[model samples]
Target: MSVLFDRIALIGIGLIGSSLAHDIRRLGLTKEIVVATRSADTLKRAEELGLGDRYTTSSAEAVKHADLIIVSVPVGASESVAKEIAGNLQPGAIVTDVGSTKASVIAQMQPHMPENVHFIPGHPLAGTEKSGPDAGFPGLFEGRWCIFTPVAETDETALKRLRGFWEALGSKVDEMDAEHHDKVLAIVSHLPHIIAYNIVGTADDLETVTESEVIKYSASGFRDFTRLAASDPTMWRDVCLHNRDAILEMLARFSEDLAYLQRAIRWGEGDKIFELFTRTRAIRRSIVQAGQDVDAPDFGRPHPLDKK
Candidate 1:
């Protein structure tokens, strides 16, 4: 493929950022990939891994003269990154992010973005529980969704360019309003992770269930929750804080549904339990059929160390 940009600045050296670096290099997406992160150690590691052509601890310096800038930091830190890079953005540059919470990211970064740059809020529905540069690999976003929540004043040419970029990375692109994106993610993504964390915590707190027993028997459904709960704590904490309202709304509904299940169990309503289970099982099948997930018995996941 032809080079999409002259210079691509990656303003975070974590999983998403490194993955993009790998894909960009693999696909020859840019002439130069400048990697930036606040941590000296991470920047060094990124250099050691050869994820980019240049490495720097200064986000502003990294973004200077870049044709495209991708901010892959936590949602809570979006504002700070925006402030640091605002004045350094080149004219007509395309700036985008891979934050999970769309509305919060827009609220934090949009104000600081220069009028000359195209600031499009985005969320790539792709990742594993693992993080860091080592956890990233090529083809991570293959066949996955990358949703853009473009602002009202977004430039059409810029939006299409960004869409073409993601498409080149093998992602299916979609567009929606920021508010709707947040609410949809709250139910589909955030709630599941929250439930996983809660279930894992509950298991840990079970006084009668020994830790050894839990580990030995975790090959069941509990293991799945553990994977989700094992995701980066800082990222999840920021996600919870940034998308509070939508998450709380989803949690309220989840609690009410849980109560209904509890009542069904207490009343020995087999039909009610079976009906709900049957309907919910279809959702998983649909996901597989839609090519969003695999139908493998192991959930198509590799060991943590194997991700690299």
Candidate 2:
């Protein structure tokens, strides 16, 4: 793969930014990479990891000579980052973001973007219950979906170039309007994380069960919820705030379904309960079939070797 851009600036050196740096360098995606983050320690770590050709604590300086700038900051910080780098952006630079909430990011960053530069809001449906530079690894986005919510005045050339860049990283790119993207992600991503956090919190606050006992006998279901709950609090907090409307809408629907399930259990409606479980099990099988997850037993966890 040839260099897609002469220079690319990463505005936050967290998991997403560092992962992109790994792929960009490995794939020869840019001639040079400029990494900038608000934290001096993160910038120092990024430098030590050799994540970029240049590292700085100033975002404005990072984009001054860059052809492409990818913002990897939390959703709530989008506006400030945009304001800080708006004056320093070079002509015809393509600016994009890896934010989870598209509409809010568009609202926050779009107005501050220069008319000459292209502002494309994007979300890569990929990540783990990890954060920071050390948690990032190569091929993190391979085979994952990268959705773009391009603004009304988005340049065709710029959009195509950005699509190509993600494709070169082995991602499947899709486009949707910001509203639709937010609504879709509300249920698919946001609500699940919210549910996980809530369930974990309930367990933590349990009066009948001891904390050590909860850990000692954690079933797969509870363990999975804890994994999601272990994610970065700042990022999830920003996501919930930025996509409040959509998240609330999804939450209401989920509450209705949960109430129905509770009613079924209370009334001993076995058929209804079985029907719902069967439907959800089918959905899990479909997810595995769709290449989103493995079909192996125990969600693909490696088995321990036995010594006879």
Which structure among the candidates has the greatest lDDT?
Answer: 1
> Which residue segments of model 2 deviate by more than 4 Å?
306-308
lDDT of each: 0.94, 0.94
Over 86-190, each residue of candidate 2 has an lDDT whose tens digit, in order, gives 999999999999999999999999999989999989999889999999888999999999999998888999999999999999999999999999999999989
Q: List the residue pairs that clash in candidate 2.
A: none
Candidate 1 weakest lDDT stretch, 10 residues: 299-308
Worst 10 residues of 2 by lDDT: 299-308
Alpha carbon RMSD to native, model 1? 2.9
Tell me the lDDT of candidate 2.
Answer: 0.94
